[model samples]
Target chain A: MSLLEKISDQATTLTPGERRLVENVIDSPTSAALGTAGELARAAGVHEATASRLAKKLGFVSYAAFRDALRDEFIATRETATRFEKTIAESTSDTILGELAREETQALGRIEEFITPEQISEAAQILMRARRIFVYGYGNAEVLALLMVKRFRRFGKDTHQLGTDPRGLAEQMLGLDSDDAVLSFAFRRPPRGYAALMETAKEVGARTVMIAGKSGALLTPRPDRLLAAPRSGDQDAFQTLTVPMTICNAIVIAAGLTAKEESLKKLDRLGQLIERFE
Target chain B: MSLLEKISDQATTLTPGERRLVENVIDSPTSAALGTAGELARAAGVHEATASRLAKKLGFVSYAAFRDALRDEFIATRETATRFEKTIAESTSDTILGELAREETQALGRIEEFITPEQISEAAQILMRARRIFVYGYGNAEVLALLMVKRFRRFGKDTHQLGTDPRGLAEQMLGLDSDDAVLSFAFRRPPRGYAALMETAKEVGARTVMIAGKSGALLTPRPDRLLAAPRSGDQDAFQTLTVPMTICNAIVIAAGLTAKEESLKKLDRLGQLIERFE
Candidate 1:
């Protein structure tokens, strides 16, 4: 069995501190794989001894052995080439499309299981109250950042997308203030500039919201509001954006609904402008 | 009962030609509402009289009356304001998130019912053979376009996103050749540069593929390959990106799987580059 499976198998017997460490390990495997036992305990807000106890509880010889196994498991499973090979080996060309669709559909169906209505409402409330919204995402996440900026702007919020380049990002960060909010998308591991952006937002007292994968729960300085869920597939498989995109839509809709009258008026004006121009 | 309901109810009695016209109307209500009977018939590749016959069969006094009702229904049901209002009226603030999630889940589940494995393979095959790929989307669709460009590039395809601006689009189109492919996303209606993009691709003999809503089935000078499905919710609700994003993911995976070895090599190189840079 995998390290995570072994950890979960012992869930009922773990002490509170041990349980906290176990949860942190599962939530951020990358950190668990890369960090020492003390760092893991500190990040999980637990006693250092809990990590070694949890390791023994899971039948490992020692804490170092447990860490070695975890690092090995992480590297073996998450290498992009290994993951892609597994995906290709599991399905022939004829079945790949159906398999992917099924995976994504199942993922979409599970959104409510991982994300709560309360979390969405909390994030939306922050978005509704912010004077301006700056979105941060990189790689595939950037597509979502652009999407959020466009949709939020349509709902009458002042919105901007932060560039991925460090220089441009620093320039943009200069404009943030207490009245603003930062909405970011992160999956798997946090992106470059994530720490700087979060620190700047904190420095300026801006409300911060993040839509991310489960790993987001372990972010050192967590956002003001977090809506985190697992993506559609195993950590090793190619994941789709369906789940996160649904969360984004829900957040936008919820925010718009929070101030119904004003949102509708903005949409009405948008419709008129489209009709006039197009 | 709604006009669409009436048409479906009479499905058993429709002639082949009448069925064609009904399908066209169901697929592209905007066209049915705004176009003349002859134009609608021609678009559906049916006899002009078939439009009138379908109208009469649906209990309308004349084709013009049918068109008028369709126009009214289309406008009343599809206006952004009306749709947003309906969404707002259907649920309390507490239930909106769950409701939207449910709607998107249902839509994602229905993807296989609308699209076929063969269609995905055909699109993927085109992508595999293309020397270059160009993606076009405007407004919200631009998000999907950006996503396709980024992912396809990762898989080692020469990919570019077609700008929404006419002058820039024309400049980009100048580079198209028979070795290239153009992929577009259109929902509700074709975007501003769609006609020119399609025409230019045709002139350059480039392969063309479109992922669109049902309305795309009737695009004049239709693309060489079309993968069309309905967005979540009715015609007017604030649609989420879940469905289209899922399709985009599937296409990307399918295309990569078509030439697995090369794609894996590219991904490995990407990983190494990331390891070196970080």
Candidate 2:
């Protein structure tokens, strides 16, 4: 596997500082591979020693070996170019939809090679056991947060979403405790106050899970659990949300499947209520 | 191509009534084929003659031939079960994420066979020219609506989201004219007001577009244009949003590509404002 791919494959096992290094490398592989160990460490807000340790963990003899691996991988992939770019060049309206679909499908497939299934199951378990779950998605991501709230609520879980209210968000985050879990979707151009909300969760010792794209590297202090779903498509073209949404679907489904008995009982009760009331 | 594939391949060219017939056939091909022409027509809320016309349109001599073709295709696919069910049965935390990714990727690929690029480009053009674009999302689809609002607004389009506002929604729809366009994301178990909202849009002569799943058959009076992104994965497993989100991405990209100069200018202005202010 390539260095970045190897880092992602082991993302769940890495420490926060280590994951930051992985995120940094992913954000700009060319620069990350060419830069000195100190330069890379500073960029990721980690010590040089931590950076070296990360490199070794990924099976590199030294940081230089890791950089070499990244360079080799980058060159190999660049020679072929992304499939989406080729699709755009050749596609007519008649053929573009299929190309778009196939590209997205390939994105989901690529994410599979990097993100571990254990990470998904672990995140689901955290959500299931929490006393209450607070979901937030700013700007466009807010809808995703609402979806999470809807899914968890269907199973009789106490879930709440912080809508378009920054003040309300601050209040909500302040109230979370260790028994609570905060699940937030922080995608590209993440809304203001993301850091504050995450900080509050940390202060109260709440479990934090972030569903984010590659720009997740900018999240200064990362969440306790990170489910990275890399966004695909040309930067100038369009940003696809398939990866993150798919992750959301999988996490919800895994939770439901793991808690099948309880979920079914709650669903039955909900059905009765709907029938009686509606 | 098979009958179903033929319908999808010509998605952009089909009429509203003919499109409804295609949707009905796709929703449950087994029933669409086994039932008489009149039965299929009734289910699609169209006349029996329309169903016959649809079959002929797909190059079949009679509706019976279309049914035979559907049965043949269905049987050929049934020998192999869904990859998701197999994944669920054998999954360890180590393997589940990859399985989820692959399944969702396949979902996108499946949608490609149905949704056409012309449909995407057309949706983009509608949003671009509208005096005002009113976006709505029912239940889980609300996120898609919000996403549309964010994307269009970034490109400096006049857009508004009918956010959880039944009273406001009713009032807003009252103001629409032929120059206006209403786009709604209505998926499974749509909200109560979906019909009312669509009705109001029609009464005002506003162009209407719907981004929906196959169950769009449940829609009372279909919109002027329909962009269908089929739901993927097993019925009992978690529902994936990859297909719809991918469609959204493609539409926005097509819109940006079509109106290149204006979008870039707006983005540039926005960048300057952000740099100077916050």
DockQ of candidates 1 onward, in order? 0.11, 0.13
lDDT of each: 0.72, 0.67
lDDT by residue (tens digit), candidate 1, B50-86: 8888888889999988987775555322232233334
TM-score (chain A only) for the predictions, listed in order: 0.60, 0.59
Q: What root-mean-square deviation over C-alphas does model 1 reach?
A: 26.0
Best by TM-score: 1
- List the TM-score for candidate 1's chain B: 0.61
* Candidate 2 TM-score, true structure as reference: 0.60
| Candidate 1: C-alpha lDDT | 0.72
User: Residues A111-202, candidate 2, lDDT per residue (tens digit)?
Assistant: 76556667887898889889999998876677688778888887678999875587877776767898999898876666677788888888
True-contact fraction for model 2? 0.34
